[model samples]
Target: MIRQATPADLQTLAQLHSQCFAESWSAQEFARLLAIPGTFALLADTDAGFVLVRVAADEAEILSVGVRPERRQQGLGRALMAAAAERAFGHGAQTLFLEVSANNAPARTLYGALGFAEAGRRKAYYNEGGRKADALTLKARLPLGKSA
Candidate 1:
């Protein structure tokens, strides 16, 4: 049951994000971002997952996405990404972009399958304690297709 999320879902979105990442974003942060033009969120039910995206000019960037650990491997992430891409395209975007931790193999695989390719990199962009991981910036054409 995927649906567009409103500010009313802020707390739930924060809770779900906390389950998927070591660092969680607060509801206040979500509220601030959502208030910005062209920023929106899509929620897959209350317990499954959600994705946040911002479109500007001809480009759209995925700010964040998360699936409950238990809900992973069940296609939730793929569905969320596909939906986000379509909506972005509908909103006059010609390109979709996202940054994923280089250490996150599963997310890289999922993004790759959705036609995203490595566009650039940010060294040591994700730091956890003393452990650091590069952020791989990925890009795909709007209305994404499966990679050949």
Candidate 2:
């Protein structure tokens, strides 16, 4: 299950993000982003995960998506993404976009399962443990459906 996240979820979201990523977004950053128009956040039940997205014109982009380390591989990430797509579609978005670290095979598989295809790449976009990693930009038409 998923629910719309509010201001009260900032700390939880930041915590989960920190646990899931090498570099984390502070609660302050999440607060600032949430204040922007067309931005939205969704929290998975029990704070297992969350996805942040922004819609503009005919497109929506996943600003961030994270699942607690222990909760990964349980379909929580997929659920959060599916919910984000549904919300974005309702708001007039025709396509969804997100960027994933090229080295992250698990995430690449997840996005591919959701019908996302690589659209572009940013060289050395992420610095993890002092190593640079490329960021692959992916795109998918909404609303997201089950993978074959």
The TM-score leader among the candidates is 1
lDDT of 2 by residue, 69-117 (tens): 8888899999999999999999999889999999999989999888999
Model 1: worst 10 consecutive residues (lDDT sum)? 139-148
Q: Per-candidate RMSD vs. true structure?
A: 1.5, 2.0
Clashing residue pairs in candidate 1 are: none
How high is each candidate's TM-score?
0.95, 0.94
Cα misplacement distance, residue 35 of candidate 1 (Å):
0.3
> Candidate 1 residues 30-64, lDDT tens each?
99999999999999866599999999989999999
In terms of lDDT, model 1 sits at 0.91
